[model samples]
Target: MVTRRRLPRAFFERPTLQVARQVLGQRLVRLEPEGGRLAGLIVEAEAYVGSEDLGCHARAGRTARNASMWGPPGHAYVYFTYGMHWMLNLVTEREGFPAAVLVRALLPTEGVEVMRRRRRGRPERELTDGPAKICQALAIDRELDGHDLCNPDSRLFLEAGPGVPEQAVTTGPRVGLNSVAEPWKSIPWRFQVRPEYIPSLAEEEQTP
Candidate 1:
């Protein structure tokens, strides 16, 4: 078992880009109600800093849906989109400052059987390769919106995991924002672990 230390609130209270970069290779664990822990290594994430960034949810100002983003650091900021899918984000920065890191993809580690089952036998590659898909695989929804990720006793939390070297990290523009304009749209806020550095199951083979 990977003896991962739960990340502290200070880990998230750092600058948005730093949080996004450091999050890669960290463990995202969910204490499943029916089984043991369902966990995965965070592989991709995007940073949204403050209300000035047009792509951030705070761009439209704080509402009931995005209030969590403006609250304490190291909290879940889950939101529903496409009328059906849920996206997971981590709140960053000090209280009242709206900065967040969107977890874009994960590489299944522990309790993959449970995740595969929840995904209804979808191919391993599709299991948690997208933001909405990760939520589906972990059964996260609006109820987890304000959950504290820094709490050791929480059902869901982040932990120190596989280390990703600088050579194995990549950055690019955040995706799925075709409607947004320049600067923000082109900012290279997306962080990902290179394929070669990921575990074999994630890139070299299909999930069985």
Candidate 2:
């Protein structure tokens, strides 16, 4: 039984970009209706600051697609992508900063049997590894938008976990943002779990 430690509200009130980098190795937990729980170790993340970030939705301000980004910190900012998948993001910074941390990849840890079922027949590597995949495996969707991540009753929340060493963590360019250009696109803000732990496409193709 893994005991989850809820992060303080102030933990999310800081700069979204920094929070994104700092959140590596933490655990993300989702409570199920039947009193069961699902969780995974955060393995990858990307940061999106306000309008200055060309890759950020907040660059457009308060539109229907990005309204949740403008809310207070510790809120979920779930969104659809590529016209097919839903991605999960956590709102960061004080109100109006419009920053968020994109949870890109996760290493399935607890309640993996449930995740395997939710993933249907998909390979194990694809289970909870990518942004859209994590949401799908965890059953997160648009309905969870703006949910309070800090609330004990909320379906989603983050937990403090073992620290990943600096040498073990690696940084790289974000995926699927070739059009952003300049430092923004090349910021190397993307973080991921050590290579050995990364799920292979073949492994990902195996169902449970």
Pick the TM-score winner: 1
**Model 1: per-residue lDDT, tens digit, 1-208?**
3666898999999999999999988889998886588888899999998889988889999999999999999999999999999999999999999999999999987778888998999988889999999999999999899999988779999988765889889999999978887799989999999987886424432333
- Measured by lDDT, the strongest candidate is 1
lDDT by candidate, in order shown: 0.90, 0.83
Please give the distance, in angstroms, between residue 98's alpha carbon in candidate 2 and its true position after superposition. 0.8
Give the distance in Å from residue 150's predicted Cα in candidate 1 to where it truly belongs: 1.2
lDDT of 2: 0.83
TM-score of each: 0.94, 0.90
lDDT tens string, model 2, 151-172? Answer: 8788799988664667767888
Quote model 2's TM-score.
Answer: 0.90
The root-mean-square deviation over C-alpha atoms between each candidate and the true structure, in angstroms, is: 3.1, 4.6
- Model 2 misses residue 44 by how many Å? 0.2
lDDT of the structure predicted as candidate 1:
0.90
Error of 2 at 73 (Å): 0.7
